[model samples]
Target: MSNEEKQAPQDQVEDVIESEVAQEDAALVDELTQANFRIEELEQALAEAEAKAAEEKDAALRAVAEMENIRRRAAIDVEKSRKFALEKFANELLPVIDNMERALLGTVEDEAAKAVIEGVELTLKTLMTAVAKFGITPVDPMGEAFNPEHHQAIGMQPSTEYPANTVMLVMQKGYLLNDRLLRPAMVMVSQG
Candidate 1:
């Protein structure tokens, strides 16, 4: 109704509007700060996830490489087995060499017997040549110290010629296929 009363109402309205605007500005600032912080946190999390993925990929590649190496080694082992398959069969035929040697040295009566012995000699030489190609060497320790690992003690005899435990006489010869001993020599060991 009066000028003073009308002015008071208008002033109260302006104060209320200013207060509301201030509160709205403060809320907006707080929301923007929170959103920026959340974005930074998300970026850091993504970086950590990417690093973990890279590490896992490296481990998987190493595992695959190791498996490939193992497979290659196994292939080599299998090839070796196939190459050495005839080892056992060759070892069993060693007695034939001894028999052939005996036939050559034994006294023969007639010309026919001598011819047969000469034929056996040719066969023995051929067999030895073939065996040599396969890395099979004869373990003929004629004058060497007798090792029980390579020689079998068939008899103990007194000998002034040989050292103690040395091979005085090799009865049946031994053989080796590679580094492995196929058969030990049947020998006479000199006693101390």
Candidate 2:
């Protein structure tokens, strides 16, 4: 073959190689771009999944804390219920206790024995202490203003010794549990 012909063939081969290399480079660039896009998509999905997981964890923690608080409150409620179970019964017994106290303190016109009086007084004081520990208290509104909420005006007495609408005498003492009235004070209010 001639020299020019050989050079022509060599140049054609170089051109073919360059074209093939360009095609390969283009394919590689497209693959790299596709891979980058896929990576970005995967990263977004991962971030979303992580965020969702964090939110779920926080929700679960809050729910658990709420349940714990409820359990603690329930326990406290049960304890309070047990402690105050006698509240109603004690309320009912307040009148009896007051009657006992009144009977013991009244002028013994009858020939009552000294030993009997001492025994009765001691019993009353003891009972009063026990009920007092359970939040029961006596309301002896003697000389205090007669409050309609705590006092019952059974009789009106005209007296210059006391102000009007004042409790002259507590006929039967009242009792209270906490702030609740077990029995209202039976009182005689002075009208004068």
Candidate 3:
């Protein structure tokens, strides 16, 4: 009816609309905050999962490296076994060779004995040749400098011919299998 009365009702309607808009804006802000929190939680979970995966991967790599090392060691062990398989057999055969050498040294110079000596000599030569083919080398340290690693000093002798600390006489011959000493040469060393 009057201008003041009409303006008052219009202002009331505008206030109601403004109040609804404010409530809606507050609801939207709350929802956006919740969504950002959920994203942060998911990011943290993803980071944790990635870190766990990385740790597992590192463990797997270490396991693989260890397996490879084991395989390499096994291969080396197999090769060594193959190289020294006949070590025990070679050791057992050494006494036979020593006896044969002793027999040859003790033979008398008879006409009939000479034929038997020749036969024994041929047999000994054949046996030595066969053993030499299998990486079995003789360690005959005759008149060489005494080495404790290869030669064992049984007794020291005063010698004018050899220098001091030299191998004067090899008592029993030593043998080597693949450059590894099977037995040390029993020798008499010159006194220093």
Candidate whose TM-score is highest: 3
Whichever of 2 and 3 has more lDDT, that candidate is 3
Q: Is candidate 1 or candidate 2 better by TM-score?
A: 2
Report the candidate with higher TM-score, 2 versus 3. 3
Sort all candidates by lDDT, best to worst.
Answer: 3, 2, 1
Once fitted onto the true fold, the runs of candidate 1 whose alpha carbons sit more than 4 angstroms away are 1-44, 47-55
Candidate 2, after superposition: displacement of residue 65 in Å? Answer: 2.1
How well does candidate 1 score on lDDT at residue 107? 80
> What would the per-residue lDDT of candidate 1 be over residues 154-189, giving only the tens digit for each residue?
998888988888898888888888667888888898
Candidate 2 whole-model C-alpha lDDT, 0 to 1: 0.88
All candidates: TM-score: 0.70, 0.71, 0.85
Candidate 2, residues 107-186: lDDT per residue as tens digits?
55445565677788888889989888888888999999989989999999999999999999988888777667768899
Comparing 1 with 3 on TM-score, the higher-scoring candidate is 3
Estimate the lDDT of model 3: 0.93
What C-alpha lDDT do the candidate models reach, one value each? 0.86, 0.88, 0.93
Total clashes, candidate 1? 0
TM-score of model 2 relative to the true fold? 0.71
